[model samples]
Target: MRKRVTMCQWLSDKIDDEPEFLDNMWFSDEAHFLLSGHVNSKNNIFWGSTPPDHCLQRPLHSVKCTAWVAISTHGIIGPFWFEDDDERSLTVNTERYIQVLRKFWVALGRRRGIDRALQWFQQDGATPHTSDRSLEWLQQRFEDRLISRRCHPEWSPHSPDLNPPDFYLWGYLKDRVYEHNPQTIPDLKAAITAAIRAIPREECRRVIENFARRIQ
Candidate 1:
């Protein structure tokens, strides 16, 4: 772990080209760093991430979750947590996802909204985005805003250098909730939201920027 940590710092430094370049890249490009989805459930509400053994058992539960995340390279996008289920319901989770995505242009308004003008967004080619409904929704929502998309999860996989949530967010979650066990789903859910909120925004931004420099 120490070696990995050192290597991560080295890589982070080189990829970024400078100490602050990492953060600048995010704010400058308006890129969105993404990753494989996170799992949330009733019976098993542990923190951090699913252990390697339980990684791909989704089909069994059929519990729905959606592609609910957003980012600004500068900061977190609005968080829209949902089950990887269907698209029938317009719950806050789903609507929240849209709202967060929409806020980029509304707030940035052709100025900071590089995504709106260049039509570029970074994401994996998950089934949801490929689905007819989600595709149509994005088409209507962003129009020409989404330019080149990074589709294959493996290619870039995720920019460990520029994406800190991969390391920091889980660490924060585990640190706070692992001790709790969070016996109930609702309890776990509340704990997660609280943990997320507790993280200092500037700290998260620093970590996210540092990620751009981490080596594999």
Candidate 2:
């Protein structure tokens, strides 16, 4: 809690010092979408004294996919699907991450009118994200407009509360996506995309604008 508070303070101070910080920033993260929707254990409360009749059996293995998405105050960017490697399992390597970044950069310009040179990108410290090759690629394009392990204004470890996607956007989308209980991978992907599209521009702006208050 102390670390989180300190980090929040640091963020708040930065935002105050640079009023244009939020406007030019893009927040990015990856999330896994499972065939079986995410069931929040805390929301499974039973009212009966004897206990609920439901028995939730955990799946031994579930079909899932990793998707990378980015958002700015303007709007949401790519919910790009990660390509599976030789093992036929989706894993983000430096090369794959770079590919997503390249595609997402183009999408940002076409969809949101954000130029790579004008935006400050934020990403968490996943292994692929922090790799030397990935860092170099980001540097070449975004120059100093990056927030990562090897960049200025680094994100703190294990601090999901500071990330808009983790704290708000993903949860919001999951709640809507799971409403249909999508049965197949394609259905799940469509549901996820639809949910993202449904998010209002005002909501995006509000979340981005509220960052300073949240940190405080």
Candidate 3:
């Protein structure tokens, strides 16, 4: 808690100094959308008199897609799905993460007319994000404006509440996407994409305002 407060204060100070900090800060994270979707076992009750064998077995290889999104006051950069060269869903590694930023962030930034030099990138201290190579790549692009571990204005550990995507976007997306109850990977991805597209730009601006209040 002490560390979190310290980091929050540091960020608050930075924001005070630079009014556009939160606007220019691109906060990012990723979440996995499972084909099974979010299970609420609490609502499950056996209606039979005999107690049947009650174990539900999931598949050995369940289909899912890891979706990444980066949000700023401008808009969302992506619902970028992490996949291999063959288009199979894959976990994020340093190489794959860099590729996503280079491909989605760079290309999308250009299309959106966002100045790369003015953007402050914020990411949690995930393994791939904190890796030496990944940090080097991020530094080359964002330099001293990064909000991450081992970077300027280092993000506090386990402080997802400080990030807009964690405190707002993910829950909002998941609730809407799971309503579709997608039974296949493609359906799940489609649901996620639709949900993301449905988000209003005003909502995103409000989220950034909420983030500013949070750190303050």
lDDT by residue for model 1 (1-216), tens: 554455356545544575543333322111111112233422234566655565454344322222233343455443344423443223333344444456543544544534444333433334433345544555675454332122211213233333344345544554665466555444555565676566665876666555553444
* Candidate 3 Cα errors over 4 Å, as ranges: 39-61, 111-113
* Number of the top-ranking candidate, with TM-score as the measure: 3
The C-alpha RMSD of each candidate to the native structure, in angstroms, is 9.8, 3.9, 5.0
lDDT (Cα) of model 1:
0.42
lDDT, candidate 2, 97-155, per-residue tens: 99999998788768645565677888988999999999998888889878886567667
lDDT of 3 at 102: 84
The candidates, ranked best first by TM-score, are 3, 2, 1
lDDT winner among the candidates? 3
Candidate 1 off by > 4 Å: 1-67, 83-120, 132-136, 139-162
Ordered list by lDDT, greatest first: 3, 2, 1
Q: How many residue pairs collide in each prediction? A: 19, 0, 0
Model 3 agreement with the true structure over 1-216: per-residue lDDT tens digits = 777888899988888899987778889998776677643322234588787777777766667788899998887878887997666799899998998888765655575666777888889999999999999988887788888987767789878777888888887887888886888777888888888888888889999999888877
TM-score of 3: 0.86
| Each model's lDDT | 0.42, 0.78, 0.81
CA lDDT for candidate 2: 0.78
